[model samples]
Target chain A: MSRLQTRFAELKEQNRAALVTFVTGGDPNYDASLAILKGLPAAGADVIELGMPFTDPMADGPAIQLANIRALDNGQDLAKTLQMVRAFREGEQVTPLVLMGYFNPIHKYGVERFIAEAVASGVDGLIVVDLPPEHNVDLCDPAQAAGLDFIRLTTPTTDDKRLPKVLNGSSGFVYYVSVAGVTGAGAATLDHVEQAVTRLRRHTDLPLCIGFGIRTPEHAATIARLAEGVVVGSALIDQIANATSDAQAIDGVLSLCSALAEGVRGARA
Target chain B: MPANRAHGALLPSFHSPVENAMTSLRTGPDANGLFGSFGGQYVAETLMPLIHDLAAEYEKAKLDPEFEKELAYFQRDFVGRPSPLYFAERLTEMCGGAKIYFKREELNHTGAHKINNCIGQVLLAKRMGKKRIIAETGAGMHGVATATVAARFGMECVIYMGSTDIHRQNANVLRMKLMGATVIPVVAGTGTLKDAMNEALRDWVTNVDNTFYMIGTVAGPHPYPAMVRDFQAVIGKETRDQMLAQEGRLPDSLIACIGGGSNAIGLFHPFLDDKQIKIIGVEAAGHGIETGKHAASLNGGVPGVLHGNRTFLLQSDDGQIIDAHSISAGLDYPGIGPEHAWLHEVGRVEYTSVTDTEALEAFHICCRQEGIIPALETAHALAEVFKRAPNLPKDHLMVINLSGRGDKDMQTIVHHMEQQEQHA
Candidate 1:
């Protein structure tokens, strides 16, 4: 079994949701960004989604967009991001690392080479936001063939007819976007999220991870009770945005992740 | 994929609604909304349903006679149809070679070719029961045009423009506001057309229920490239008839400037099957293509995805979109339409570029000699015309789509001339 599966199984046994913490690779700079990433597991991030910054982050709100700009301005590219993943793997091997961003970087990097390098770097999954199932032959199938999970997103507008098709080729956990708007723009109601999770459950046995607009520990806890995982991206990046210095940026993100992890840990109890 | 086609539609479609599986690579944007391996619905899942609806509606509307009738009525009376195929006698004599004709799209409503597509899209928006219209503009001509159509149709209008464009084309910004559009300044990613498009897409995704995104160029997701091309094909259709009427034969060559490639594709699509006709698309070389600052996507770019479609883009090796630099705001985008990418790959239409210096000279030449104050965007075509026209035989007929007027470009022109004077 993959590290992701093993971790999810262990979490299922623990009867608590997984805290999926997201941080852009090389935000501010590489060393500081890597430090924050390496410290994620201890701070309670079960699954780390290291953001691959692209020039145009269309689906993202202001906070994540700025995070992308910060990362890019600091001279971060796909190569350095892989290096960060490789560095993260030096100590922790069990925690699954997912690279999340738009597909152009990976497409430009050459999909075959990217998937191989990512697997070699101890990366477990991919959440290429812009690549849909229709264009799966481009990235998803190739990534999966090279032993990486190509996670698919199920948004609020993903009607019943499109659900099965979206889930068919999808591996790993399904990312349930709680709102129809851009990421970090609109918060999803617990009632809406609960219903969405239930609907998605009928389609696939893949662990449903809800994200988009779950900002606080309360928001995390409320959602943690309903899904197998809780994704906190923009809120965590907001920490990096609010910090005065690089060290404070890492400090701010880790502290917030620790709190959110605690909230997820307490959800079942 | 064939099951996805809209059934029993009336008028002929731009494409025959091919299967999405891409069984054959002969034509483009198959049922899956792909142009060979280029275009697709590379958007958030929240937008899939909406994009599908748009594709279906556009498919149906293309077949419906009422839609065509209304569009023609607007073209003839409101926007001004068949904008004169003027014989540029001085330009031809100056060229000392080809018999040159200008397909004067500069005479269209709003003083540019932008109104051609906006009218079609606004009517579709009305048909879709959409209460709001949103558009992105680089030159601000599209904003003024969209605002004009929205006012005509009684729909609420919002236009997203880059901060750079907003400052440079302040007159058009005021024109949009005067036409009742709320212009939102987008300050991201080089603060240009591509960024403005990103902002507009964000707005559409957020307000998908009530809004119809009126993309100014022949770019974006599936139906948009095909739909906008179909709307703007009026330029080519009229040119074909006008050429047949005047010269009794198709022109030896046709040229139009490209940004996201609407005007070029508009002129090129109708002539795709014409064996004798040669089509050329001119891109903005900015300072020059060698400087890595131009908007010549095919000339100086690689294939990548941006703003929801796979196309040739001026991006880094890491797939980061490189900011495009151009004196002409309309051609300042970093990417071209997906179909242009496909057509370029297949070697049908030739893609070339003109520098700011060359375009400025062409702009002045057209104004002084032809008495036509062409837009900076249009001047790119004129630059190419000036180059090739001098070498060809006088009997060799050529038509250039003057896609817009230069009234909105005085500031850019004045600014450039001043900079040149200082250097001299």
Candidate 2:
């Protein structure tokens, strides 16, 4: 089994939920983004979702959108984002890294070449927010061939009838959007998250990572009690955006990561 | 909430599988969702149920005799379908290569062929009891068409356009606004056609129950390509009858510019069986093919899924859709319709690229010679005629689908001309 699968299995055994933190690669600078990524695991992050910036990000909320704008302003493209991941991978190999972004930049980069590059860069999986499961055949086949997981997202609005098709095809943990709206919009209601997770569990045995509108340690803790993982994206990126310097940004993300991780751990204990 | 719950259950099966599956499969998107390895329903989980519902509904509706009767009535009364096929006698003689006929979609009520598809879709939406109609546009042709139909049907209309497009295509935007339609500017994603589509998808996702996304072209998921093509077949149906009467024979060549490729498909569908007649689809090569600035799908694109269906798309190595550029805003799209992709792959149609300069030259040539100023989108097809005319014998006939008039593009063309003179 791959390291992500192994890590997920271990987390399940320990009755602990994984903490996934999202940050835009090259948001401020490549080196700074690398530093932040390298620091995340030690700061209590179990998985790092490195965002590949694009000109258009339709599914992203304000925080991640602004973060992407900042990244683009700094001249971050596909090659640069992959290079940053490679840089982070040099020092840290254990923490599973998921490359997250819209599909345009990747499509511009040839699919086969991207899968090869992603595998070479030690990317464990991908979460193309806009790439629906129906269109994921191109990415999923190559990813599976490369021994990399093609993570799929299941939302509350996903019809129960079609849930099995999405869940069965997906590998790694299923990234379940807790709410119907875009990322960073509102808090995921506990009942809604539970219902979605329960519905998904009926379809697949894959770990479920609940995300979108996840803010505060309490929210993380509450989600941890029900799901296999809790992804803190817009909240962490918002923290990074407010920080003054690279060191300050890393510090802010680390603290938030620690608190969220501790909250999840506390729930497990 | 209770009503919505009931609607949800009814909606899922609204497009009955048994009825739609056969016809839907006959189109580009196969049952497995491969449109010659291009079109598939690549959408979010939240939208799947709705897309499935729409697909099923489209299938059932297509077979429903009442739906067909209603669509036929609207096509005749509203869109003025069976639009004439005028022999461009003056221009044909001036060119002196082949007989040329123009499929007079320009004579349609809205002065474009877009209303044909809009009338059909709006009628379907009304039958489905949808309250609001939302659409996206680049050159505002589709928006104007959608707004016109919505007004006739007395439905709330909302059109999303790129802010950049709104500024550049101000007259069409104003026309839409004046027609009791809310024209919302989409400021994201380079502020262009793709952005407008994204915004429309978002609106549909948020307000799916109350809204009907009147996709402007033959692109999008399964039912749309087939539905739009069915609506547009009127173009071909008229041309076929007109050709038999006027030319005494089938035309040797048929040409149309491809944006989302609805107009081209409309004209191309009826003739797909006639293998002798050459069907040429001209794509926009913005600067030139070599400069990496173009929307020439067959030349520069790979088979991939975007929006909702598989088609030829301009994308990078990683499968992210690249923004396409063309002087004609209508043709500024990253991908073409799934059927076009299938047709190109199957060699049923011939695809070529037309540069901005060539299309503009043709635009001016037609304006000066024929006294007909065609939209830049149509100019792409006109460029093909210029290229093909020299190769063909004098006896050969070429019929071009003059999909729209140039009224919507006057300001853009004038501004472009001023810029060119300034540079010179």
For each candidate, the DockQ is 0.75, 0.38
Candidate 2: which stretches are off by over 4 Å? Answer: A9-16, A72-83, A102-121, A130-137, A242-244, A267-269, B1-27, B303-305, B316-321, B368-371, B420-424
Q: List the candidate 1 regions with Cα displacement exceeding 4 Å.
A: B1-27
Best by DockQ: 1
How does residue A165 of candidate 1 score in lDDT?
87
Evaluated at residue B222, the lDDT of candidate 1 is 89
Q: Per-residue alpha-carbon lDDT of model 2 for A1-269, expressed as tens digits?
A: 78798889888889899998899998777777778888889888988899998655666666887888788777788898889888888888688999998765776677888999989988899987666766656577778788888889888767777787777668888999877667788876788888888888888888889998888898899999998999999988888799899888878888898899899888777
lDDT of 1 by residue, B213-268 (tens): 99988899889999999889899899889988999988999999999999888888
Q: Which tens-of-lDDT digit does each residue in B1-424 have in candidate 2?
A: 0211222222232246664444332345567546656666666666777777777888888899999899888878877778888878777777788878899887788888999999988878887899899999998999999999999889999999998889888999989989999999988776788889978887776675688999999988767787788889889888888898987888899999998999999999887756567888999999987888888877798876578766778876555567899989999999899888877766667888899999999999989988887888999999989888866788897889999999988888888899999999
CAPRI tier of model 2: acceptable
Return the top candidate by lDDT.
1
User: In angstroms, how far off is B72's CA in candidate 1?
Assistant: 1.4
Which numbered prediction scores highest in TM-score against the true structure?
A: 1
